[model samples]
Target: MAETDPKSVQDLTNVVQTLLQQMQDKFQTMSDQIIGRNILTEHSLNNDNAVLKRLKEHQKNPKRVKVHREVYLKRNMKSFTLKRFPQ
Candidate 1:
C-alpha cells in the first residue's frame, strides 16, 4: 500500500550493498580460519558421507568459493570424480 521514493530506494540499495559487503568480509574471515578447515577435515576423516557433499558444493560453484578452494576441491574431487565437475 506504500510507495517508496527515490531517496528511500537509494538508501535501501546502499544498506543492502553494505550488508552484502559485510557478509562477504565475514565469510572471508571464516573461510580463512583454522577452525573451519579443521572442522571440514575432521568431518571428512570421520564421515565418508560428507566428503562428496562438501566437495560438490565447493567445486560445482566457482562464484561461491575463494581461490584456495581449488586446492581443497581437487584434493576432494580426486576421491569422487563422478560426483561433480569443475566449474
Candidate 2:
C-alpha cells in the first residue's frame, strides 16, 4: 500500500471541516424551524389572553340550579336501571 502524503491529509481535513460546518448550519436551521412552530408568538399570546378574558367573564355569572324537594312515591319510581361494563 502507498503511504499517504501530508498535502492529501490536509485536503481531507479541510473537506471534513467543510462538511461539519454545513451539517451545523443545517441543524441550526432545523432547530429554528422546530422552535418557531412550537413556541407561541406575540400575536398568538394576545389572542389567547383575549379568549381567556372572555371565558373568565362568562364564568363569573354561572347558572344556578335549585332543587326544592324529593317526593318518594311508588308510582313515580322506575324499577330498572342500566348497568355499565368496562371494556
Candidate 3:
C-alpha cells in the first residue's frame, strides 16, 4: 500500500475510491430499504406496545404439540450376471 510507483499508487487509489463508492451505494440502498420497513428497536419494543403484550401472553401460554417421525431404509438383494471389463 506504501509503494513508491506512481502507476501502482494511482491504481491503488482508484481501487480504494471504487470500493468506497460501492460501499456507500450499498449502504444507501440498505438505508432506503429500511426507510419504510416496520422495524422495532430495543427501546421501542421495551415501551408500551402490542408486540410486548403478545410476547407476554405467548410466554404465559406456550403451546405444546407432539411430533412423530417414521423412517425406513431397505436394501434389495441382487444376483449379478454381469462381468467386469478388462482395462
TM-score, per-candidate, Cα-based: 0.33, 0.46, 0.36
Q: Please, what are the lDDT tens digits per residue for candidate 2 over residues 1-87?
A: 144333687877987888899999999999998889767586688899998986676577444111111232322343222223323
Off by over 4 Å in 1: 1-7, 35-87
Sort every candidate by lDDT, greatest first.
Answer: 1, 2, 3
Tens digit of per-residue lDDT, candidate 1, span 1-87: 135433677878987888899999999898789687898998887787676777788788766677667877888878677566544
Which sections of candidate 3 miss by over 4 Å? Answer: 1-7, 38-87
Q: lDDT of model 2 at residue 84?
A: 35
Clashes of each: 0, 0, 0
Give the lDDT of residue 44 in candidate 1: 82
Mark the regions of model 2 whose C-alpha exceeds 4 Å error after superposition.
1-7, 41-46, 59-87
Clashes in candidate 3: how many? 0
Error of model 2, residue 1, in angstroms: 22
What's the lDDT for residue 10 in model 3? Answer: 80
Cα displacement (Å) at residue 64, model 1? 53
**Which candidate would rank higher by TM-score, 1 or 2?**
2
